[model samples]
Target: MSSYLDGGGGCRKRRRGGERIFKFKSFGENGCPVEFDGSFRNNVKALVEYGNLEMNLCNDGVLCWTFQLEVHRHPPLNVLLFVVEEPVRASSINLHCKHCRYVGWGNHMICNKKYHFLLPSKDTVASCFNCDETNSYESNPEKGKLNLVELKGHIMHGVFHSNGFGHLLCVNGMEMGSDQLAGYQITEFWDRLCTGLQARKVSLCDTSRKRGMELRLLYGVAYGHPWFGRWGYKFGRGCYGVNKPIYQKAIEAIQGIPLCLLNHHLSISNNEVSVIFSRYQALSDHSIVTLGDLLHFMLKLRSRLPEENITSSCNPTTVETNCRWSPKRVEAATRVIVEALKNREFRWVSRQEVRDAARAYIGDTGLLDFVLKSLGNHIVGNYLVRRCLNPVTKVLEYCLEDISTVFPNSEALIMNNSKAKPRNKITKVQLMKDIGYLYKHILNDQKPTMSTGVLSAIPMATRIILDTKFLLKEYTEEQLPIRGNSFKLFCTVTLRNNEGIDEGSKKPMLPYECVSFNENTTFDELRQEVEKCFREVYWRLRSFVVEAVANMSVKGSDLVVGSVEMGQKLVFIGSNDDQIGSEDSSGTGIVDCLCGAKEDDGERLISCDICEVWQHTSHALANADADALLNNIEKWVVIMMNLQRFYLGILHIFTCPVVRNNVKVL
Candidate 1:
């Protein structure tokens, strides 16, 4: 909300408290705007998005105004323009803007092992602090000096010049028109760019190489375009201090007229809240306003917010406005208002809605009570809703979650006074070290806790990538026996070379190598033959799973134990060579089949695939499609679909033990 304030002197009357106030403040100027890249500012969108352009207008002539947030590379600086038509008869009035671009920069941490920082002697210069130290990022270069690489320009060391600011206040008699109409954002262009006078004297500590800056200079001139450079000042008169305000005012107007708020990519805080309040107060003094006006007002006064939190404003000197106001109450009210603003109840209509709701209440006292209660009960837990992520914090959270979920406080939930669940079991601070191990063994990253790359020679170092830094801290040869159902990880290590330089290269030689069970089967124990098909390492080791089936085929079948009718399994007893003739020999070969041996031809046999059993004709007909044949499904089942099933030779049967303890569903 800053404007480039050039000297534009005049008189304007603004209505405040129904009294006319004439403004002739010398701290004023012509509207020489300092244009910044205002393309994608979204500060105003924080409020709420309107469904359509029609939603922004109201019968009270309340129109939405725009203000661009200061952000880098946000495009289309003047994407939207908003102007409230002023009365044709109103006197000509102009308001000046003073743009204030801040100076100074913050030191950044080096990306590599060497400590890096910006040169305080010259803000743009970059340098490293640990170039020659033992831990500095490097490799063997020459015999004498450590390998030092010089980084040039600001970006080499990384830069963080915080968002620069702009200021807007009355420059002329614009109070001539009602503040409501004039408050609508008007985009206008200005001219002129300036540069710094000259470089200042620099004192470098050649020995230490780096020192933090004590006081940061607040230069009004924009970067590269310092207005003082064009002023033609002499070293004799201290011209920089004298002409800073004048040059700053002139440079403020050098930007294209900004129309509306583009997009605000920066986070919002109480500072933005304060700015909004100030603007609302300024405009509302002249006329009634809407929620959109309040939004712009917040952006205007956001700069005035105190730099530090007023934790306990016990000191009066630190207070602003000559300490006339209590900082605590002001801050509290400001916070509460911001909290309410997060809720979208104050949209659509304006002051009229508030008045209507108040009048609709049972009484004025009742409305006041409700307001007080609502304010008191508000939680105000998360003041600023942000979606930013911090990697360090996220890693910490993961560690905490692993500990909490798997290792609870042993007090499992109770049920009917009987123990129902397991207890807390993971040992605290059990580390899996990698520092010394990795320094010497750089090629492989497979750890005892992981079973991921057991077959592959290449080590992906899954444990390192998974943010277990807390557990991978200290180096130790001692092993801690792990006990817990919370996490099931097991591994064992063996090396082919256990002597000389190759001893440390002892990797887990077996794919099924684990803490509890190590699979190292000898060749003799395996049968005379092995499966001819190709298989992966894990599957090859588990080949014993099919050994029983293979043996059954070569030797004899194993015993079959199942739940079945007494006579169902041993249906034929001593009878054999069963294949009964079809009842209708020509209709279909299956229609006349019956069960019995060839010698017991006409003994009323029941037809079937596995067995042809001799039974009475009535029994053979009535027992078809019966449960006595299915035998509890889990062990074995004869799916008899109908009484004619045997006639159709549909003696389909299947068997398997579904209740095995080791069966895994997925």
Candidate 2:
């Protein structure tokens, strides 16, 4: 007989040399031994010493034992009972296999007395007996090979030693009816094993006292299984394993596991899961939930409950409002803006284009502005009101300065191969040509009327004058021209006969002349010079009227010849003696309206009493109901002036519909 210590440090004896085996119904007619095999005997002894196993002596002197058994067919049979005819042994009994030199006593090649004489069948054997084949049981004809679905149902099993080191036994799926395996059975089994291990210390300790000890590290062998990696298990030296000191892999596993399955297994409510997930999200700065600190938090939660759910659906509003700005996302957005500008031909980009580049990461306009403002040193404008002239329109518009300019300024130089060259001084002849081209278009009615569009076109003609540097002229009291300071004005002169008939039968004689003048020339002096050119003409000259075109309309204002802008058009109307004194020489009676209508047309006129400017009544009023308002024009002007709607130009008059219907109007 061999003696060993039981769980309470009491000595126990094991019976030996029993050739006459006593059979019990539980062990079958071919009685099985109650001794453990060499490989697994130490694990059984540890469990017994920790009080995980219960032993009692029966009235008949038979020893009965109760414990949990985790097997391949049914996991965690929590109340397996066995009767021992003698004292339970603590030491392992080793047996040898001649074929493979394997020295395990139970289930390796054959079941021996160590396994209570249980027969070595396909379901119970670990290796083949005669051939020493390790995979013989898996290849057995009676046990069909597992399909992909059945293979996915594998479960995990492990034991944590007192030294804080854990050993994984196996993760294998059992053969079962199709109905028994459904809906993430593998994860379910893993949760159960983890739960059992977490409670192992508590369940083994005496109930009268409480212990706070827990497993620290869990290491497992995956046996070349690829799915082990999918569960956050890493590999080392051709074996897969997991280490949970900080539970980094545990958090990874929780992230991959479905929330619904976790909730089901962990018995966590949806609201509780949401709270935990929200807390994690609030603490994480970036859009993604992969921070190390957050992962540590989730691992701590999982450690507390073992099966605690760590992932759940988050509230979108809460996530948007509470999440801190991420430096990585800001960096990404900045990179996008820079790249967009770098790909462009100009050093400036519109605000809309900048917004579009970073829209994916920074959706809020104000937040995007804040980001742009933070890059103020790199960009050109204040966040809200940066302005740049549009290349196409030449109009000032909101824009962002290209970050490429601030970073190196080399990218802009490389991209803009056709950068604008400095404008040279425009010659007098070139300025004349540009003005003439504009006049030609205006005379042909091909250009739009003088509105904002025509005003925009003025820059095209004036750009030549703006680019030129003219030398100032020194004028004498006699007004003799300074040679270098003089420019030629090209004009077309039309001469009419005394009776207002053309000199030619087909058309009036339009003579072209080039008049030269200096900066000191007055309007009267220039007129006299032009009169000298036609001194010998048969028709007597009338008053010489010089009119300047202003605001796209010919105005009768007195012309100061030397003060004329470079591109301004001038008209000289010379009538015969019969036409003299018939019309005002200054042409003061002329009127121009905002609608481009002039005075003395057939349409009735309505004039603003205050400014005395005339507008055609048809152009000013949509209906005749405004006749009363027109009669009281002074009162209407006062009301419009008080409302700040009175403009000095053409009058746009209208009586409200309420007044037309005879309703009292405010």
Candidate 3:
């Protein structure tokens, strides 16, 4: 509230309404008296009348006003004004809640009423303050409640620069009790004030302007009122004028305190310590701390130590040395690398690419390299030169060996030819399997013969070689048809990693094997053939449990196919097992289920007692019957146990109509 211009000559004048006006003789850069023009003067007079504002002239001949109006017999509200170059000392101001009328001053204020603010528009130089009342302890009705009431007055001040821009500073409402003003009322006041200032050619700075004015707040004032952010005020401009050095010193003092000590003193959780430390680390020598952030720091220290000792405790004399690649920095760098890799299109990435991606977060190169090397599976080559062969070039070279197309040895020709060639539809796994099949026939000293399916699945160049050698033949010409319908079944066998065998020493297995079968092939015959093939490929299936599952290519999921007569892709997953299954004389391992639906169809299956046929509970039982079975499951289980026909493996049980006319009731 201090005047920018001081010791200016004053000339007294009178208007027609007998209202005295003191004109300041302060000169502008143009040598003209820095006085309000007649139009601005009249505008101020009209605003004062409309708002019922009481006008007053300061000793410096500057105009000011106090808002005091009663529209409907309301009590006269007093407007409190305080002028200070720095923050108002806590000792000088009294803090109180309007509800309890408690007049005690403290570092923290507790109120039962929660206030909500409506932010101002970005273009408006003024701000509107309002609040909605929320009961803090609504669950406990017996507790005393605070009510929302109209605030006494708004606390604001204006400062104008000689560069034709102005800044309007407003104090937070918590201390002055002026936060509950209506939106329209605050808007009207700001509009009139801004208009008068604009008439005097004092343009308020707006963010939309290319070269807007800077609004600087006092370090102490802004730090004391964190709630000003709710009114759209940002506090990143440091402090006003000479107070910046003091603000920087305070920031450094706070930063000097160990995060662990702060967490312990504040009773903050370990999980929250990282967050608080991150925010603390963000504070630099040139920044100010909001009151909300430093509230606990100030209260705890002030309560335990004297004012002079507080600074000493915050800034301890001892300093602890830390490693450059600390655990926290390593973790941060790892997170950045992981996030970058997730966004990347390819699995393989170079060290330089990773370094560039994480440069923003991890400025230190040595720390990033350490973290990269620590990633056991992610790192490809040497610690310094972590690079992978370019996948695009590898794909192009692989295609060149398969296709008949020829191109120059230059990089440009390879790239262009790769695009020009027909897109290869076969996967690398399929191509490898075809080559293995051909090699096996040759090793046996037999003529290498391939069906149309195998020939079509190989690369174009390999297909041309087979055609020229007269090794590929039509499906009908290669062999006569079997008794019934015939189809080829594609099978994949995945062997469990043996304990004693090294991965590199193990033989390379084909991706999948194809076997021809007819409708005459029984389930037992198909199972035997698969087991024989597994033994020939790896070893005997004695040490492994082979579970065959059909991969429904259309559905993109593996399902247990009932028959191998139809063509389908099968996956044989083998796991090492120490104990082989003993033959069950009662046939417990056998699945003689009548239900055609797959187990993964999400329906509950129940087994019958007599035939031991698995049937879907939904299809076999009525809703009420199923509910009754569920309600009395224990009794039914006891009945089944007594009959020696209980199957604990099955979750639900009910007799199928085909086995029995009526379901036996327990």
- The regions of model 1 sitting more than 4 angstroms off are 1-246, 249-309, 312-348, 358-362, 365-666
Worst 10 residues of 1 by lDDT: 395-404
Tell me which of candidates 1 and 3 scores higher on lDDT: 3
How close to the true structure is residue 521 of candidate 3, measured as C-alpha lDDT?
58
Evaluation by TM-score, superior candidate among 1 and 3: 3
**Candidate 3 segments whose C-alpha is farther than 4 A from its true place:** 1-43, 49-195, 198-244, 251-271, 275-666
Query: Per-model C-alpha lDDT, please?
Result: 0.20, 0.29, 0.29
lDDT of 2: 0.29
Model 1 has a clash total of 47
lDDT tens digits by residue: candidate 1, 159-252: 1101101111111112323221111121011001101101111111011100111001111111212112223211111111112222222222
lDDT of 2 by residue, 197-269 (tens): 2211100100010011111111111111122333333321100111122123222222222222222322332
Task: List, residue by residue over 260-344, the lDDT tens digit for candidate 3.
Answer: 3333333332233333232222211112122223433332333354433212111101122665555556656766766665555
Please report how far candidate 2 places residue 377 from its true position, in Å.
Answer: 25
Error of 2 at 301 (Å): 20
Candidate 3: give its CA RMSD in angstroms.
Answer: 43.2
lDDT of 3 at 573: 50
